[model samples]
Target: MPRDGSATRERILETAERLVIDNGFAATSVDRVIAESHSSKGSFFHHFASKNDLARALVERYAAADVAHLHAALEHARAATDDPAKRVVAFLSYFENDADAIMSAQSSCLYVSILTERDLVLDGTSGQIEEAVVAWRDGFAELLRAALPGRTPAGVDIDVDALSDHVFVTFEGAFLLCRSTGDSGHMHRQLTVLRHLMEALLGAVAATPPRRRRAGTPSRH
Candidate 1:
């Protein structure tokens, strides 16, 4: 059986997550969290040493959930097609609707918010969070590489890492723009641009022929 203290701690964390999502870090105070969770100061302190600690936990939880969703989307795309271009389109399209909801709900990019608060979050345990971000990027890169295979434009190498970074930056920028403008239309336009760029990249990769394997090298097949 779980202790009452554990239940109270869970309640506090849940309330904190919602408040942070709805109100942001600066606006959501310990007092607000207490009021929302109906938790006492002693209970809050017992679960979290400080607001920063609670913020860190919130970031970790958010990152984990986001990564899981991303993985599921990528897997669904992967299972649906053998063509790399189609897979890329399917993967990016998964976020088309999600981007709008995310912007509308938070009025800010949660990951971006966490990143901007790195100084506060980096008391000592940012490594895992950093890895989570990198892993998310790498996941996208891997999907792109699998979809494109050895197809590369003549004298123009396709850098999967660079492509992944570009996509990530564009996505972050789109969220910021939407929040700044308080308009969903801006985010929709940005996603359209993102889709266009992805399509162009996939087309370029598909148009190129596979590089020749080295002599005596055995193919995976």
Candidate 2:
């Protein structure tokens, strides 16, 4: 792509992501995006076959960036701690901090807004959206699985996928509640509960191992 085309593409995607987050996918229009992005109609059509095509590209582009941020967060956690469970907690903490920013009136996740429009045009946008969602869910599941060796609470037998689903649901539900109630704090509160639940479910170190006795020393009474 030419330098100008690449820049125009990015601008279009950014504008669409912002508009969709604010007004929802169904409510936003291609003309609005073109106008907001400051690109001509021909340029918009050059990069996107239609609004549906733009939606598809939006999902892929935004999802890639979002997933990359998650990966970086997890990596940073891994660097700061040797414990896998702690790394999982760190990942959630990063999201909590991010949600704090959102509550401060930053934009909510774009994918959340896009997914609500289940009637998206059948221009492959559905698959793109699904792929984006699964990518995010799987990333969390992979981390949770890594931390699941012996951390779950007693009598619990959840697979990684189940745990991932729970975490993902918590996030999506929180977003919905916050948007519906016009309460930004809803997300932070829900995520706090989620973090605590994970600690209970996946950080359950029921008991400590017995300490080793010193050589030639008497055992504890």
Candidate 3:
């Protein structure tokens, strides 16, 4: 039987990704991944030249997944509302929901979490992370831009690019705060605040936030 080369590589990547995310990249050694993955040095080297290369691949994968998830959520929002402002609001809700879902799944994005792990954030990988962040802001900005057909709403001077940055940066901050505060619901709270602010800016009615179900009740998500 032929050795499953792809499976071997995938196991190495998956094992390393989990380790690097749990521990800082610089701290997670190649031997740790090789030991945990039950793969030999040859197998690990075949897939990745060095620890840095492996981390870079992980960041690229993380960035691609983030972009795909954002696009899917925004598409859902677009379908739910005809008003551009309303759609932007819906995007926030969806983004928050996705964050919650990610939390529940015990998954994290290397790029978003990389900002704090200074020791492990290599320049080559940081480039990919930065690009991913910029893409997120641009994607968000597009939603805001779509809200207007021509002129800005009367007296509503929204610098589209700035607003985009505001939304992404705020969410990133909220996420970090949520982690630090040990509050799972903090993400939703931040989104609600953002929704209110956006509604005020666009003169759109605020959307109702999701209600909390009693304990043992299933989430509808």
Candidate 4:
């Protein structure tokens, strides 16, 4: 049978992504990926001409996935509620579920790793990260626009753009804290706090935080 080229490429990418996330990209050599993935030099080179090429591909793939998650969360939230405030809360809940899954796997965000090792990756990869972050800002901006009118806190002016950016700020900060503290539940807890704060700001009823998972228990994303 002919070699499954796409499967081989995906396997290499998957292996590289895991290593880059766990260990810094500067420390995860192509040789390490080859050994870990059970791929040969020729196969690895065939799929990725160089480590730089692999880094670019990784950022592209990660950015695409991040945008997809943003859209999916918005879609699901819109479907669940017509009230824009509630929809915004629902959108955040999607990420809370994601935090649980990441906690279970004991993996941090690949983007965070990429950002910390900014000098190692190409400039284009940084652009991809910027684009993903913008998508998130715009996504939240849309929801907040619809939800904020007539609901803004008394005597307070909310900049839609700044408020939208806060969503990303909160999440990325929570991830960093989780990495620093070694507390698996940190991300989910921080997300829950953001959700409640949004509820209060938008005058929506706050949803109860989901039950805490038992230690070592797996979570479904």
Candidate 5:
């Protein structure tokens, strides 16, 4: 593709992403994207074979950037601290600190918007969305395991995987609530709460004594 063609394609993608994030994929149309992007139908079609193709491309681009940020944040957190618990807290704080800016810049999550539409467009993106989510879940779980290297609080066995899922759910739910309430601070507050919860959990592990395993008793890992 020529430099101008590439620029036009990027413009269409940006316009489409903005529209889809704001109004959802179902309501966003090819004509609207073409008009809003200031590109012709010919250019739109030349770039994307169909609306589904556009959606897939959007997901591919969004997922790549999203996962990249996730990885970068975790890497930064790891470098900031040698202690597992502090590293985990640092990771959460990384997002919590920027939640306001992130919320101000984006009205809603693109993945959430796409999922809510429940259209075949999700399939168009292959497994990009799922992979991005998995990356988040797995990344958090790894941090959680590192934080709780031994026995959990008292006799309670914390499920790191489930806790990881909670992180994703909380983050996404914050976006939903923020969008619904039009509260710019909602996401930031939610992230702060999540970070506090993680801190408390870590504190609990530190404060509580680990229960000794009884002889002949089965362990519930």
Candidate 6:
């Protein structure tokens, strides 16, 4: 049988999630969570070792949801277009929409908030949270590479891996800038520029002929 105390624990977590979302992790206090949950201090501590533990749990929960949505968006983009460049643009568009909705629903951007507090967040158990965030960024880079398999330049040498990293970093930065400025227009402008860059890269790659086989190199197929 489950302990009746489990219900109180859940209430505490739920309240913490809400308070953190609404007031931010730093601003939220144990007193606020307790009042919000209508639970005693003992109940809160019984459920979580400390407020930091609750914050860690809240970040993990948010990260899981964000990753799931990102994967779904990537899948949709892949299914929508065969061209790698087109797929990348589609994925960014999907992400832009998601960001728009989040900005509208919550006055705060969770990822941006965590990133801004990197010094503090990195010092504790939240280090795992930072790792999760980096993984998410790397996931975006991987998706970009998969979408643009023919990224090798012919006449001029270009590093596909570097290019992919640039795209991912730029996109993430654009979101942060948009949120900081409270201007959705900035996101749209930045994405438009990114779309153009994608088209140019694709065109450049398409214009290049396939690398000629070496005199005695065996073909894979």
**What total of clashing residue pairs does each candidate reach?**
1, 0, 0, 0, 0, 1
The per-residue C-alpha lDDT of model 4 at residue 183 equals 79
Cα lDDT tens digits for candidate 5, 1-221: 57768999889988998999999888998999999999998999998999888988888888877887788668867887788888788877767766766776578878866766555544656467888888999998998887886635678888778899887787788988988898878887898788778888786322112223223221100
Better of 2 and 4 by TM-score: 4
Candidate 2 C-alpha lDDT tens digits along 73-174: 566557756677776777676666566554544346676676666656344566765665676678888778788877666787887776676766776688
- Runs with alpha carbons beyond 4 Å of true place in candidate 1: 1-7, 21-27, 149-152, 204-221
By descending lDDT, how would the candidates be arranged?
4, 5, 2, 3, 1, 6
Clashing pairs in 4: none
Residue 140, model 3, lDDT: 81
| Model 2 alpha-carbon drift over 4 Å, by segment | 1-3, 103-107, 116-121, 204-221
What lDDT tens digits, residue by residue, belong to model 1 across residues 37-106? 9989988998789988887777776677667766765775687567777777766665654554555445
The lDDT, on a scale of 0 to 1, for candidate 5 is 0.77
lDDT of 4: 0.79
TM-score, cand. 4 vs. native: 0.88
Best by lDDT: 4
- Candidate 6 has an lDDT of 0.61
The candidate scoring highest on TM-score is 4
Tell me the whole-model lDDT of each prediction, alpha carbons only. 0.67, 0.70, 0.69, 0.79, 0.77, 0.61
Which tens-of-lDDT digit does each residue in 39-143 have in candidate 6?
999888887887767766666666666666656656766786777666776765655444444444444445544545555466564666556556556766776
Off by over 4 Å in 3: 1-4, 106-108, 112-123, 148-156, 206-221
- Our model 3 lands, by Cα RMSD against the true structure, at 5.1
- Candidate 4 residues lying further than 4 Å off, grouped into runs, are 1-4, 118-122, 206-221
Please list the Cα RMSD from the true structure of every candidate, rounded to 1 decimal place: 9.9, 11.4, 5.1, 3.8, 10.5, 11.2
Tens-digit per-residue lDDT, 89-170, candidate 4:
9888777766867565546777877877756444566778888889999999999999998988578888899989988888
TM-score of 5: 0.87
Q: Is candidate 2 or 4 superior in lDDT?
A: 4
